[model samples]
Target: MSRYAETYASWRADPVGFWQQAAEQIDWFTPAKSVFNPASGVYGRWFDGATCNTCYNCVDRHVVAGNGDRLAVVYDSPVTGQVARYTFGELQDQVSALASVLRGLGVTKGDRVVIYMPMVPEAIFAMLACARLGAIHSVVFGGFAPQELATRIDDAAPKVVISASCGIEPGRVIAYKPLLDEAIDLSENKPDHCVILQRDTQLCDLTPVRDVDYAEAVETALARGEGTECVPVDATDPLYILYTSGTTGQPKGVVRDNGGHMVALKWTMEHHYDIKPGEVFWAASDVGWVVGHSWICYGPLLHGAATVVFEGKPVGTPDAGTFWRVIQDHGVAALFAAPTALRAIKKEDPKGTLIGEYDFSKFRTLFLAGERSDPATIEWAQEKLDRPVIDHWWQTETGWAMSGNPVGLGAFPVKLGSTGKPMPGYDIRVLDDAGNAVAPGTLGNIVCKLPLPPAGFPTLWNAPDRFISSYMAEYPGYYATSDAGIIDEDGYVFIMARTDDIINVAGHRLSTGAMEEVIGSHPDIAECAVVGKADALKGQMPLGLFVTNNGANRDESELERELVQLIRAKIGAVAAFKHAIEVKRLPKTRSGKVLRGTVQKIADGESFKMPAAIDDPAILDEISAALKAHNMIGEPV
Candidate 1:
């Protein structure tokens, strides 16, 4: 047996002890006396009694260990055609200077500081600066609507807002300062100050009384010759508050603590990603999302690795070869991206010509997350790259991968469609409505047995009752994931779909994810999403919307028939998957999760509002037209 197997078994036997040992790896200002405290009536706390500064662990310690000269971050932007690298020492100094600036702005420990910047080095600097001062940083994804930004501002009520003047997109520049100004104008609770990075002075507005230039702040701090001290914070102090889309249409702020998050991410960087210190790690995600928070910014830094901050898409910024070019140029050992990204790249280059043009000898592994990974996308990628394309499952609530193939530990057996076994700290189960564990091969709700592992969201920011009712109340002693999946006899877990995403045909429940997986596997199809439409006799039926590969020559009607037949053959007739339509593109969020619910609502002619996180708002019109043309639903008069 592999040593990873031993480690898993030992962790299963003693989870608390395993995590306690893991926590010892970090240099804490004051060591923790207790590993976990759960009986506090609220959410459980981890690493209790510890005092540490997160910035010190991520930046200062690496510099002190003689790795200061090693590159800590590489900022690559295809939009601007610029490449910049920062060493550990340089990053620490920048973070320190910014920390001093925040202190000068009256930001003290526990104060909320909102970051509204693009995918730039300054964003990381702002995050670390907040950590250095023990202030909670809430980073909103750049380019969100003014109302959405205002809502976040009203919630966090930060004393300072840090942002750039503009953001660089594929063929355009987004003026972020205007949006920030408009948001603050619309907000009921205005921030006391605004710090703007003047990426474009021509497009920016400075409020003399309330705003300060980032360059001027840094220069002043440097001139003062003051070393900003890293304030020691309690182990359970809130590090950041990230808002994720909630079921009720209100965004819920997920809070991550300092010590537990640091410990868990460091462990994941080594155990899950299999990259050690000094190796390059690239997570192709935006900083607004949890993946970006955990992997892109903090995780790699905590593990002493160089993280690449990419400001480009998987395709069309330069071309379909963007990811390949980055991998080859940066020597990225492990790459994490959404499945939607791979699907888009595969659609544009079905023959993998783009991949063939690059030399990826340094690339070791490929991981997929954020959204569900279809077996077709995973197989094509793994075969094309000649490496393992691992698919893992976790949530924004959980900071890291809860179930994933540990590539560094050993070559675990690959189950193509399965996300892999639960990680060492997670005890996952598929439970029925009554909270009983379901038998193997039976679909049920996915839940994690309490107390949740370290690095997990302890509670919603300022809303402990919402946290309990949202996650814990559904299952008395478990964290209800609200996702539906099944566990195989061999313990491999397969996430079928979200619980609410299940389609009911007559009395049989069908998984849209399962149908999409089979449809997407068809050689002609590049990607697909399935939603349920109302049927006269069956009550509801599966409707698959798909994008074809570039070289597919079949007509839309013929391709639709072929996809329907393929689903019928693979998933059986009980799925009632009759309709498949060829669409130009499926609507997706900025993070690349397909908007299946929006598609379903349109098909059913139900009232539904488009989520604010949608990347392309006009895509909804295309979907509505597709539905009407196919007679799946009639056009609104």
Candidate 2:
């Protein structure tokens, strides 16, 4: 039997004691006066009055423990046909040298540094360097539009901006220097210096006095033997400020503390992922995302596990088998990726033939997050890889998994439709509009009890008021997850959809995610998205858009008819799922989340801002054309 029940009960019994025990794994300069201070900032603070250095815990401590030769990072870039590896010792040298350079540039404790670069080892070094100096780092996704980057720059007011000349895509090179320059020009807050890493794929001109060559600066620092040591900081000090899109036009900076973040992420590396020291843990996500921050950079390093910095797409990075090749080559133990990636690979290689090309003997569990994992994708991955396809739920606010099957605790039974049970420290509850408990298996708002566990954001950077209003205002003593889900009698949590994705269909509430799951299960369909469109009589109706699998040639009309029938049979006629359109592809964010809200706005003939994280602006036009061809666009209300 799994130890999940006993472990969870232990945490529930003494949340502070549980986290305090986990804290012993990290190397702290000063032990906390109190494991938790209920009178601390916002909801509360963990490890109050402690002192720690995140960079030292992640890098230096490993060397001091005689594990310097152990692999730390594996940089695999299929797009560039390059591979590089670093040990704990090499990582320490790199991070310290860069920290010295930043210190020379006047970046001190409490200052903010903005990192805007591609998936290169330098980006990781930049983040660690900032932490070494007790400075906060904010990583903006490379190639973000100038306006979006400018907004982040204004909000962060960074003292220095570290970026690259360009980022390489499947068939093209995106020049990032021009975008960074334009963003700096557009923003009111200007950094004192800009460090640019010039990639061989593309070169850029740098402005004198403002732009600094990354290699030259690092080489000088190394040659002079001016490596900087880690600076001790309060446990409550901010480690990084990650900006997520806000409901308002501005971006909300999610603040992560040094102490709680290290303890929590280190615990997850062993418990949630079942990864051990020296094992290879690959989180196939960009550094700009929370997954990259926690898993790819910090979590694995803190646990002494090797992390993979992959710079390629799930497909078209040569072919659909790239992921398997990397896993086999690196001896990856656990791999975490978004569901959209699996869908893309499955669409290109429908028969799972590419997976057989590589021997992934070391690969263990496959974790899926970022977006809801439809049962179809999970089943396909499980069948092809013959491994557990664990779908966990988390957000940018929470640096680690909220609900997941604890593989190290012997893993609970796999429930295809549910995102497992709540992990330790998360007291999940389903509540109605009045904040009352809802019946089992009934859809309602999902929330967690007050005083969220460690690694969760304490407050929005410079905006505690906004944090309260955005997340806690509506649910009174609870931290509203803003997700609509159900809990079965067995205690499995089924996250059906975002609260906004729930539709009122003829006075009945229906989940678009449920409809998408059924439609995606059809053999011909590779992936699908369901959105609730405006309907005059029924308040709202479900609209389905899907892409077909490779080599699947069926009449569009027949496929549409089949999809409609499938939904009706599965969800009954209450779904009103009449409109099903086959498209070349669905619009998605760079992180691979479907832009359903944007699609809904377009279908309703309502104007919507261009999403900052959208993968391709052109995909919106394609979606619009498809809606127009099918006469699905409704008049603007």
Candidate 3:
């Protein structure tokens, strides 16, 4: 018999068995023969024999059963102040038509496509259609620059690229077609077919440059004879390629297969979220990164639930009240977004204070990820929103939710900082130097234990060695999450950042080592150190301290421009210099591990921690001198 574990006593008994049972929640097209595969290259498979089309379950199941005619998506646009709703059947038809359009563009099974659009209903439909047809879709965030978009296109090498005319918000209109054109121009691996969805223009005058109208394609598909059999995708078939923010070198290409992905995502929804049919589920991820791939697309869709895809920023024209208004207005049951957005809204709360005006009675669980949520942020949101803001701690590599405040199965007491207990069957542990389990209260590296869960990458799209080195090689047998964590005495897990060496810049994962390498590659530079500075907007931004060998020859302003251009050429515009200082000496220990925290402290105009390995304290003066020269000292955090 199944059981619930809302507290420690109930949850500590056994977790793997709970997860094993939860896998049965989704209506599998076929049964899985094996629960786990010990192999390293391929991601672990959940339902080995399962064969279900994700769209069929998300759409056809509910519609054919005649249980849903209610609003599926309540799209609230910030610019026009518009609210549009779509029925479950309407979404199903849209998905089917979109799938037909994709087929028409020669996107067969196993083909890769890029869907670069805003958080709109059509984008969701395109993603569902891809899943239905077994075509892997890589959705890049619309705000990403051309260089960043081009890098993703090069990595994925998609056959088709989809974009919209323009999207509106409080600040500005994101001209999608123009950006897409720029990205496509930069990329040698350009998609043969470019489909444009003209959203802002009622009568869109699409530049006649091999552009297929999105609505026309959908209309054509809607008129097509229904396909007899849905695409029979196996458990191991590659479903999508969700590229992480390339903070280190190139972005690590995390490929999710059909069976294990659906299994893990569906399992996450069932156990961690308790999503049910006919419920309105809304995850505010833009469907670009893993959060969107799993929750926004796979999870709700696989469960035959109505998912919401909103196309506006949280802080729209009216102020920061947009998110709360949408929640109350739509009766959204489940909500998810990054902590960055929450912090912004917290600072810029709408006029006439005390954020208790809206009714959040309908909204049950609130999910947060992308970056860690602080105690103040969580408390503020809960107080204002009047609901439990469940802080979920997982990454792109983990595939689905690993350590989170799971819904019902294990509703453990909310620890101030903990990301709650690991979802059932996650096989998680905090290990010490020797990879042995640490004491409950001791802080150590987090690792996924034996019989690996099926969420992490099954394999890199074309680079298998890259996949192996990224996850396995660093820690040997156990999968290294690169996150510092602690499994507290209370049995809850708390995660810190990626070993303190890396910075979570906005949504991008960046490494101090990688940034230093890029900066050091220049001939004029003697040595360079990159440190992460605390920023409310972009979780953290890289502040570079460069020691130029020929510092006397060039002006600081000229060098700054040169360094920025060099970084842009080397690491693309996304990782370009936020700020740089031409320093005389870098605060490094004799044993060499540049004291980034010390640099960060210096950046924040605070005291520093002297590493025992540092040979000379006098170098600090040089760093201070550099900061003064570059005007970085006394910078607001």
Candidate 4:
């Protein structure tokens, strides 16, 4: 039975009384009598006026309970096979020392600090250190090129920048000092100083005017006894700026508040993961993204759980088995990574030498996010890794794990392609375009009606108007997730795809993601992208483009006919493809996101606009070739 199953039974029976009890978990400056505002459609407010420092909630509170000596962080160094563990007490001290260094460089409350580093232990240290002194951190994803790096630096102007030697990325190690050197030469507002974390663990070779070694700086500051005074922060104070790849095709700075983010993530860790202190845990996404921030750094710390902030990709380095090795080599209790990582693993022969050696006895919970997990991948992982891949669904806007197949308490009968039932102390609904609840099994946008739980929110940093216009204006009076999903009879959520990812073929609506998955599942088709192409009679038709797993040259007519048949088999005649173009590769962003709109632009007989951020522009040619071969010839895939 789920820990909250009885409460869920009662809550489902009478929601009004259920939240009245749920609201008692936190410290509230002003008491909220109710959890819902039926009239406004907003339903969350916990401990109104409550003020708590996020880092404090993460570390100090745990220390006060005498678990200070317990593990707070586990560092699985790819360079060294050793697992570095830091107790809550030692982690707090390091965070304080780093916070002092940040303060010494003149970063104060409300000042922004841009952190571009690999998912190393220092990345978490820098983030919490900034939080300790009330400095908002804007972390750019580590995989970005120099130009995209500059854009983020421009967006979040910081007094001091923290960067690491990018030894972990593909090909050349992206020396941060060089990029910092170039970005500084270009920017009018260059960082006052640059603190370099030697990922190469080597001293800086390039010259930047005010460059300082990160480790030595912290050590020097600690010796001086001039540590940071952990400032008292307000609930509404800006905590950190996490950038999200919004539909606008540019990274939107999602400015999250300290208290609100803390409350939400902490609640999620406690209630969803059922996490306990001293347990070793790892959230596989890098600290550069929200997953790294909420789950890996702040949330775990806030809740007093030990966390692993790894620096390397699972597939890179000596072998793909690195992640499995880390899990068994270290007793990782809970592990979280994106389904993107898993899909890549799935594409690799499942019988690869990597899956057989690990001991999974220590793993209790595993989370898959970034994108929805294909159910096949979930079952395969369950059998291979010897644990359930709790296929989770959430976005950058939701803070942390909003919907998850809860492992410890709320395990339900696993539904193929379904994220679990709603979490404790929260309510979720699937709403139509009209904002009314949709019938169960009928697809609708996911909506979290207001009075939003402490962490549940709708905002784009400081831009309230943008938040209102984007989330609110879409469906009117509801926070539209923009993603298509359905609520099963058991209240489990099955996210289909992004809502706009639909196509009309002979007046029949079809989802490109579902259809693309069908194409990708084909034996020779290793990866695929399907999009709607404008047509006269049909209005729109499905056009597919793909990269073959075996990279075999095939008869164009034969391959095209085979794909059409595959779609017909999976989705019926109504959703069969108009044409398919087999390509060597599809255009993808650096983060492995397919540039779907770019493909649509090509299909529309228009010139595609490239985001200046993409690291490789050559891949666009392959899309063009596939499209041309399939007679999608106006432009590209």
Candidate 5:
């Protein structure tokens, strides 16, 4: 067997040993006596009998190992035009002081602390502080609608809420304090204490009874030389709760364990990204999302790498060159961003001219995730950047990458549309409707074999039954990913779409992702999203919504016909993808995922609630207008 195959075989032979060895990479207050216990359901209990402190592993260990002067975090904000750097010693000091402040407010082990803040350095400080005090934190994305924040608050019922005065977006300053107060008032469960970071004192309001100034608390604690000792907890202790969208459209609080998270993320840094100690690692995502929690916050820090906290949008925060500028200025080695961001850059600078203006010599690799990446975008990025542009796939339920091109483990030939082979720790397979394994090159459900890897979420907070019904009940002895995919003969898996996105047309299942890929590759198109619209003859037909390249002055009718013809030629005439509409833009989430479900609803003339996570709710109006112009629907009811 080859080296990669041999290693994988050894891991399969002894899964427990594989995890035990991986856990040794991090510091443990008490080593694990049992690697895993299968009696625990779903993901099982990993590293049972272990005791550790995540903050100490991330911060204190580096400082104590004589690497105190090494830079730990580099904060770059285009909105504020400020750059701040922190070393291990300084970060640890700040984190410790914040932990002390939380303790002063009567927060103890297992208490939930709600962190609703912007993508600022203090957000990291608050997260690490909670970890230090063994307090479980639920970080709601900043600028969420008051109702949405209230829903999360009611679910978590945190004792303390940490927030900032305002958050800076591309063209506006979003006042967060007012939103926080409104959410608190709307919530049925109220937090007893509120720690407000006075980011803009003029724009902030304080409640006399519950409010505490962050600067005052931290400064006082530091002046008194107050220090918080990292609290050691059991391996299965709840670390933090992250809310992810569920099938019912309500947020499901995914619970993660302390030991498993620390070990798994450290493994990801070296094994997945090939990042070494003190290397600059940047995942340009918000801290409110899982990508931020893993790569941006925990993964890089656990590996002793310098993590960049980017406080800017993908485009128009200055220009499309913002990312490249940060990379050049900070010597960023590995950068992770969504494909949508790349598409935006491609649209803004069609010739890849801005990349030439910046020095990207230090950059090694660019990783894309959060959505399915098109081959055209990958080809464009690779040709322009002259670096490996890898598409890795994972979800919020899984803390790190489940499948990717692990260059550190072994370099493999690039597959244009595939997310490479499954990572070492995960055992993946494709299954048919009846839970039987499917043949290669056949589209079916994606399922992970029993006993998911350590980083897989343990359970949903206060809703174990929902977790089982959602992921486990579908397939016996396997965790259904709720996504559809196909395994090629070479073992590379191509993710087609979500199971719900599979449209059955006259007894034949078709993937919207597959159709979108072909349509998006057209020369005039910048990006496109495909959804199944109801049809009388065919069960469902593919409805394509696309945007043209920025400044591409093309005849809409001519380009639409050409794209439809291209799709028919590439995917065969049975695709029946005749309907293609040109729109000014596509509606997307703040995290850069195209809101396909919403678009489909709008196209079908169905009533769809405007999602609070939408980056621009006004885009839905454009989608409605396009649908009306096409005579596809009467109006968006």
Candidate 6:
């Protein structure tokens, strides 16, 4: 039997005592006066009155404990054909020198530094260097449009911006310097200095007074023996601000504190991921995302494990076998990625032929997040790799998994459609429109009881009232997750869809995610998305868009009919799932989440802003054309 029940019960029994024990794992300069203070921030604060340095806990303490020679980071970029490794000691030297450079440029405690660069090792060094000086770092996605980047720059008001000349892709090079320059020009808040890393692949001209060469500055600091040490800071101090899109035009800046952030992420490395010191843990995500911040950079280093900084696509980085090659090249113990990635690989190599090309001696677990992992994709990965395909659920606000299988405590039996049970510290509840608890297997809003566990956001940057209105005001005492889900009698949580994705079809609420699951299971379909379309007769109807596998050739009309029949048979007649369309590909964000809302807007003939995070704007045209061809476009309001 899994020890998960006992561990969760222990946390629920003594919430403070549980987190206090977890906090002891980190090296703290000053112990906390209280494990929690319910009267602290917007909701509450964890580890109040403690003093700590996140960089030290993540880097220095390990070296001081005589594990300096252990591997700390492995940089593997298939796009550039580059591979580099760094030991804990070497990583410390690089971070210390960079910190000295930032200190010389007048970046002090509480100051914000903006990192706008590609997936180079220097980006990781820049983040750690800022932490070493007790400064907050905000890393924007490398190739964000100038307007989007300008919005973040105006909000964060960073003192120094560290960026690179360009970012290399499979068939092209994206010049980042021009984008960074345009964003600065567009924003009102101007950074004092801009440090640019000049890559040999493509270099750009830099402004004389404002721009500084990254290599020259760091080399000068290193040669002059001007390395800096970690600065002690309060546990409640903000470590970083990650911005997510908001309902309003402005983005919501999510603040993560230093103390609780370290304590919680460190605990997750050992427990949720089952990663140990000196082992390799790869989170195949960009540094701009929360997954990259939590796993690729801080989590593994804090746990004294090696992390892989991969800069390549799941496919087309030479071929579909790239991910397997990286895992085999480095002895990866656990791999975390989004479901979109696996689907992309499965689309190109439908038979799992590429998976057999690599050795799996050191590989163990495969974790999926960022989006709902359809049962079809999960079963394919499990059967091919012969390993546990675990799907955990969380959001950017939480900064860690709220519900997952704790591999260290002993993983529970796999449930294909469920995202496992709630992990320790999360008191999950399914509530109805009346704010009352729902019965087992009943679909309703998912929420967690107040005083959310550590690592969760304390408050939004400069917007405490918005934080309350956005998340807490909905349920009075509980934090609203804004997701529609159900907890079965067996206590397995099934995340059906986002609350907005639930539609009323002649008074019956139906989940688009459920429809997608059934449609995705068809052998000819590689991936699919379902959205509720406006209907005059029925309030709304379910519309499906899907892409076929590599060699699957069937009449589009026949495939559409088959998919509609499949959904009707599985979900009953209330679904109103008659329409289906085959597309070249579905539009997605850079992080692999389908842009369903955008597709819905197109189907309704409504004007929508071009999504800033969309991977390709051209895909929207294709979707619009398909809708027009099918006469599915709704009358514009």
lDDT (CA) per prediction: 0.89, 0.93, 0.69, 0.70, 0.89, 0.92
Off-target runs (Cα >4 Å) in candidate 3 are 1-20, 39-44, 201-209, 223-229, 350-354, 433-437, 502-637
The segments of candidate 2 whose C-alpha lies over 4 angstroms from its true place after superposition are: 246-248, 635-637
Model 6 residue runs over 4 Å out of place are 246-248, 635-637
lDDT value, candidate 4, whole model: 0.70
Q: So what's the TM-score on candidate 6?
A: 0.99
Clash pairs detected, candidate 5:
none
User: RMSD to the native, candidate 2?
Assistant: 1.1
Predicted candidate 1 versus true structure: per-residue lDDT over 1-637, tens digit per residue: 3356777898889887999999977889998878888764365789998999999999999999999999899999988888999999999989999999999899999999999989999999999999999999999999888888898999999999999889888777889988999999999989999999988523587999899999888988888875598999998999999998532367899999999999999888988889999999999998999988998999999999999999999999889999999999999998999999999999999888889888888899999998889999998998888888999999999999889888867758889789998888888999987888889989889999888788888899878899999999998888999899999998888998999888788889778888888998899999999887778788777888988998787799888888878887998889877778888889999999998888888888888876878888889999989888888773321
Local lDDT at 403 for model 5: 81
TM-score of each: 0.98, 0.99, 0.76, 0.88, 0.98, 0.99
Q: After superposition, how far is residue 232 of candidate 4 from its true place, in Å?
A: 1.3
lDDT (Cα, tens digit) per residue for candidate 6, span 1-637: 7899999999989999999999989999999998899889877899999999999998999999999999999999998899999999989999999999888888999999999989999999999999999999999989989999999999999999999999988898999999999999999999999999999999989998999999999999888988998999999999999988532388899999999999999999999999989999999999999998999889999999999999999999989999999999999999999999999999999899999999889999999999989999999999999999999999989999989888988899989889999988899999998899999999999999988888899988888898999899999999999999999999899999999999889999888999999999999999999998888888888889999999999899999999989988999988988889999999998899999999999998888998888888999999999989999898421
Cα lDDT tens digits, model 2, 385-404, are 99999999998998998899
Q: Superposing all C-alpha atoms, what RMSD in Å does each candidate have to the true structure? A: 1.7, 1.1, 12.1, 3.7, 1.7, 1.2
- For model 5, residues 431-536, the per-residue Cα lDDT tens digits are 9999899899999999988787887898999899989998889898888898898989998989989999999877888998999899878877899999988887
Model 4 lDDT at residue 341: 70
Worst 10 residues of 3 by lDDT: 1-10
List, residue by residue over 130-173, the lDDT tens digit for candidate 3: 88787888887765667778988998999888878876656566
| CA shift of 180, model 2, Å | 0.7
